[model samples]
Target: MDESGSAASVDVVLPCLNERGALPWVLSRLPQGYRAIVADNGSTDGSAELAAELGAMVVREGTRGFGSAAHAGLRAATADYVAFCDCDGSMDPAQLPTLLAPILSGTADLVLGSRQPRRGSWPVHARIANVWLAWRLRRLTGGKITDLGPMRAARREGLVSLRLQDRRSGYPLEMFLAAHRHGWRIAELPITYFPRTGKSKITGTIRGTITALRDMSAQLRSARHLCRGGAAPSVRDTEEEA
Candidate 1:
């Protein structure tokens, strides 16, 4: 922690979308010692106003994609490290230290928060979709990306290098592929996951499912082309294959 009460000199970015129902609880749970910024994706629920009231610098993302909102938040960050997460309370903010551990210790440039073993939490369709997407991403990137969980930490420079391309559903997988292609050291830490409050914006809908599948497939195809040039071993690859 620093004198300014942050775990590291990094900034935390949360992307919100009418998260007013649960955003405050998430904010309150953030490790007291950290500085945070909230990027509201044109929420009419006063999410931006509420976040401002809670002392988080709020940036507006008129575009309505998870990646777009996060990118907007990342731009607002001015720190050596930038961590991005959803404003939903499913992820534990207290475990931020564990997620940032690899980066802080110089072992990794990107830190992903993997969900611990769980079942019967979310709808069966969501679970299945998550598993399928993760499997495809791992196969495409040759990295054992266990979960597409949104809680992630990364060094600012490497993160910027990723140049996250997807403005929608494929963002996490796209970021991982970009990092892998650029030889950024990536690591993951197990974190708890729970069903979030409020209706999910991405599940149990045909459009959502199609969008996720299309985006993942397109990104994976592009990643294959990128990997045909060369391959960098992933931390998971070394651990498992060795």
Candidate 2:
């Protein structure tokens, strides 16, 4: 049992790039009884070493994509439930229980931590983009999803069955769409969002936003095609799962 007097049953996966400055803060705030997995995407700032020193299992992935790193972390997770949180300091690791509660109570399969942005936490342009994308998602899936924030949790088996294929920014969208298609129960809870410690790789610049938009647009199109009775692509487990 941990400080909370509960046995650890969740693996919290942090898909990190060069988040050395933010990782320590995030790790320190994590609630008790949760295993931390730092999925390092070629961070040159010794992020992996820091995570290991902090007692997190560090898994290094050479592929430089958010989805790739996230998937790798999920594959390495051994818990019955897995949670994803950004290591960029914007998300609070202490609030993880909010995402995990619904899943553990059999009320939801996936629980997203919707950003209740603190003052100055979000840029105007990014907030507008997120609102539009979330609107599109609600329309496409007929679900009450509000934000596609990075902080989320789901059952390990249910997530794996989605066979998510996006290796870029579209990964989160693909997960939602595929989960909806597969009849997985999804929910969201509001969480505090703070300013990040360093520059964001995505949503920090016009070019990054455009690239992310392109990738997610393609994913939305593919989801539409699949919904229209198109053949499903072959699903394969990651090497870790194999």
- Encode model 2's per-residue lDDT on 19-133: one tens digit a residue: 9899889999988778899998888888899999988999988777788899999999989889999989999999998788888878888899999998988989989989998
Best by TM-score: 2
* Model 1 bad stretches (over 4 Å): 1-7, 117-120, 229-242
Q: Where does candidate 2 stray beyond 4 Å? A: 1-8, 232-242
In lDDT terms, how accurate is model 1?
A: 0.74
Candidate 1: worst-modelled 10 consecutive residues by lDDT: 233-242
Residue range with the least summed lDDT across 10 consecutive positions in model 2: 233-242
Provide TM-scores for the models. Answer: 0.86, 0.91
For candidate 1, lDDT tens digit of each residue in 2-66? 33545577688888877888787888877755677898777888889999998888899777776
Q: In candidate 2, residue 59 scores what lDDT?
A: 92
* Global fold similarity of model 2 (TM-score): 0.91
